[model samples]
Target: MDDHVSQAVGRPDLVRLDERLICLRFETMKVLSADAAVAHLLSTGAVRRGDTLLDSSSGIYAYALALACHRHGLRCHIVGSTTVDAAVRTQLAVLGAHLEQMPPSADLKLDQNRRVARIRALLAQDPRLHWMRQYHDEVHHLGYRSVARTVAAELGNQALTLVGGVGSGASTGALAGYLRRDAPGTRLVGVQPFGSVTFGSEHVSDPEIIIAGIGSSIPFGNVVHSRYDVVHWTGFAAALSGSVDLLRRHAVFAGLSTGAAYLAARWERRRDPGRTVVVIAADTGHRYVDTVFARHDEALPIESLAPHEVTGTDGPALPWSRTEWAGAPAPPAARVSPEDTVAPVTR
Candidate 1:
């Protein structure tokens, strides 16, 4: 029934996981933004068929942009992070997208920096190429309008709370922005990994990983700090337990970021039983099988895990922490001029 595979992949399934909690699951979440961005660019004459689109991605967005390019008859050139796995690389290759993956690095900041540097270099060499600034551009936010409508229609007038990873500010941020237009009381809770600079948790590093794709080491221009009503900073161990428990209890196989969001969602629902909490599962568990699911035995009991409540960024500590964001401005580390979110002209 769809014109392109991207349409099917980008469409999410809303599944009720509990009496007051639901899961908004996606195949490859970035496909929604990629397809919409490409379509808008074509309509506005910023790009055309056979032209190349360039962007930097860690993993999810690379495959997403590749699919969008395939569907739209455009070329995709991805400056990928070291986190991009072999499976994603193969998919990108098969889809005819060009990938320049960075060398392996454990430090996320270095990996992100390397990808951005490569993108800049590529843009300098080819002014004809359009950069899909997934982390910086507001155009990416345009895609979630329909998704918000879907949520509003399906959930139907209950006091709503949306919980998801604050990735690039396009998914969770955009959805909350759209959902709030009609229902002004809709609450937005952002999930972050311990080391993400986006929400000022960078001071405390998670020993395992930052739950990649959910959190960022560098500041993302698209992240509007004021949108969040609450923020949860989760570590690798806590998120792993959440993912393992989610599969065991709810039969939902989702990624690391989803686990973090699920953990936060459960807590929020417990505190506010009257509100319906929707957790965003951005992708499936396939990519995280070896890293997270395989370590299921190491997962702790979810009932035993509770976040350390903090009033401010400095108070966040340990495996999990929660803070009342309460419409605060961007933290000092992530403060960027509003214009940074604007898409730049092709260099």
Candidate 2:
């Protein structure tokens, strides 16, 4: 953890904070959603030089909207969920963004309404507030598509056997579009919470995926309608533990959603060992300190993932798959040159 993260979460670093490679995705995968928000804010004339703008989103959306509003000299008021990390909240707040808490309501336990209601309350109090409805808006796709393009570019002709997530349908949808063009060999995969009706299933699965920011009770046209190849299910605790172990071993700090993708990736890899599997670790694990880092995470009742070596599995409708690499093996110590050096060892 960085000093800022330590201060934000108000904990002395007993263990050094390690940020793992975590599949940077690519430079292109970076900065999804902000550009669109900026353009929309200007084009819609939804904000003025000194007016306050209202945004309802999780971490990524909040960060993007705050940046857009800030650039235009408009104050942004963001209402975020408790599931959002303290570090993310702190960063946005430090950027001069005002944050309002979203209390969990009886009917809105998993519904994003508590935050929406807060934003609505802010708007009710002031007419100058422009609400950026990200859930239904197409502009949000701008950034999401960018991420998808980046993911596709990262594949670089390699076969992508699986891809999927629950929340922010825009991100997954855009990736679907990009993969459809660039990585033609790529396969699409999606996951949903067991009872989620939006992803097109109401049959409450035995062990529903519990990662926050993914899975919904409502059907999302943006996600469900995409050209998906397959859909699978995972338990929350299982995915959570998987993410934690990923951090501990691979030194990869991924958010729960990313972990879910990893679980899917492993499942796909099992169907074919030679296939190149790409996992989209959408967000960092710093957002999950409350749970993974702690002996316990109170955010959700789901279980964390467990460590297991990747092994091939046989099945008809495997999570996902593609053809193996076609070639031969170079035996015993192929020529080595000084130019074929590892990273510069200063020591």
Candidate 3:
């Protein structure tokens, strides 16, 4: 029998929305990362058959890890954030993955901190458990190489602009790096929520901003700031509006992060009508039916801002920002078993 699920994880649809804009729908992008991480550990003998894989996630990564563990015949454990919903909880259970969800907190930073703390406690309890540091570890970047190669092969030698939400930085940053190797003129545009601190945006306490799976309140080591040519801090209203517009216009049922990317792609298209803009659609909209779709009418009207229209005073300067970390070295690889002598995986 064919392993359809394993085969389907990384091969998402590359769709063309218009002459200038395209969408890379990675509904199972995290699954690809999890598979690569697990495969690396196995190939390096970092883990044995009976060992357990562990990690901290908001939602998608946990589900991905669970699926990966199931395929590899390993146990899985997750320290999930408060944002994890009932559906995800059920999926984890079905996958035979243990989950410990953090208590509800309005602040995402606090939630992440608590999840990390819990993961540490869990790690202390078991020597056989391996932590897959999705946020900081570079191994996660290996999973996106195929996606980048696919983009390069499909659009050969074209001046391209890659747009997506910058989370752990693994997905967008890694893809940008790979694509640029073949097409050096490829521009990278990272989209972040208004309240996120990832791209040096001012921190605001807005419970109303419910967009997850994209922006982060804390720093992510995988995010390479220098790889980005432009950054856009999208507000909740703008993201919600974009999500709605995607459903209405393109019939693309995507999540808030996808909406933010779509909005940024539109701006990019307007900025340079000649360049081909590709947006990464990370996930679908089924998980957001109640919070996003049900509350669509309440979304505030957003006047699309041109690249120059965005002012720096509110956050980082529009189009460009002084956010690059000077002389920042690459983060150390995740600790592996002493006996495991394999070199770190690279794209």
lDDT of 3 by residue, 1-347 (tens): 54847657657788988897998987767888888888888888888666788888889999899988888888999999998989899999998999999898888778977886787777667656787878777889888888888888888778999988888888889889988887888888888765566655544444466467677765676777778777776666667777888887788999888887888888778879989999998888888898787888865443543333443324443222222232233223212233222222221
Q: Which segments of model 1 are wrong by more than 4 Å?
A: 337-342
lDDT per model vs. reference: 0.91, 0.52, 0.76
Task: Give the range of the ten consecutive residues with the poorest summed lDDT in model 2.
Answer: 323-332
> Judged by lDDT, which candidate is best?
1
- What's the residue-level lDDT of 17 in candidate 3? 88
RMSD of each: 1.3, 14.8, 5.0
TM-score of 3: 0.87
What local lDDT does model 2 show for residue 306?
26
Model 2 / residue 44 / CA error / Å: 6.5
Across 1-347, the per-residue lDDT of candidate 1 in tens digits comes to 99989999999999999898999999988899989999999989888799999999988999999999999999999999898999999999999999999999999999998887888778778889898999988899988999999999999999999999998999999999999999999999999988888889888977888778888887888898899999999989999999999999999999998998999999999999999999999999999999999999999999999999998797798799999999999898887656545455642
The lDDT, on a scale of 0 to 1, for candidate 1 is 0.91
Residue 35 alpha-carbon offset, candidate 3, angstroms: 0.8
Candidate 1 vs candidate 3: the TM-score winner is 1
Candidate 2, superposed: residue stretches over 4 Å from native: 1-31, 43-51, 104-111, 118-127, 152-154, 183-185, 200-209, 219-221, 272-274, 296-347
Clashes in model 1: which pairs?
none
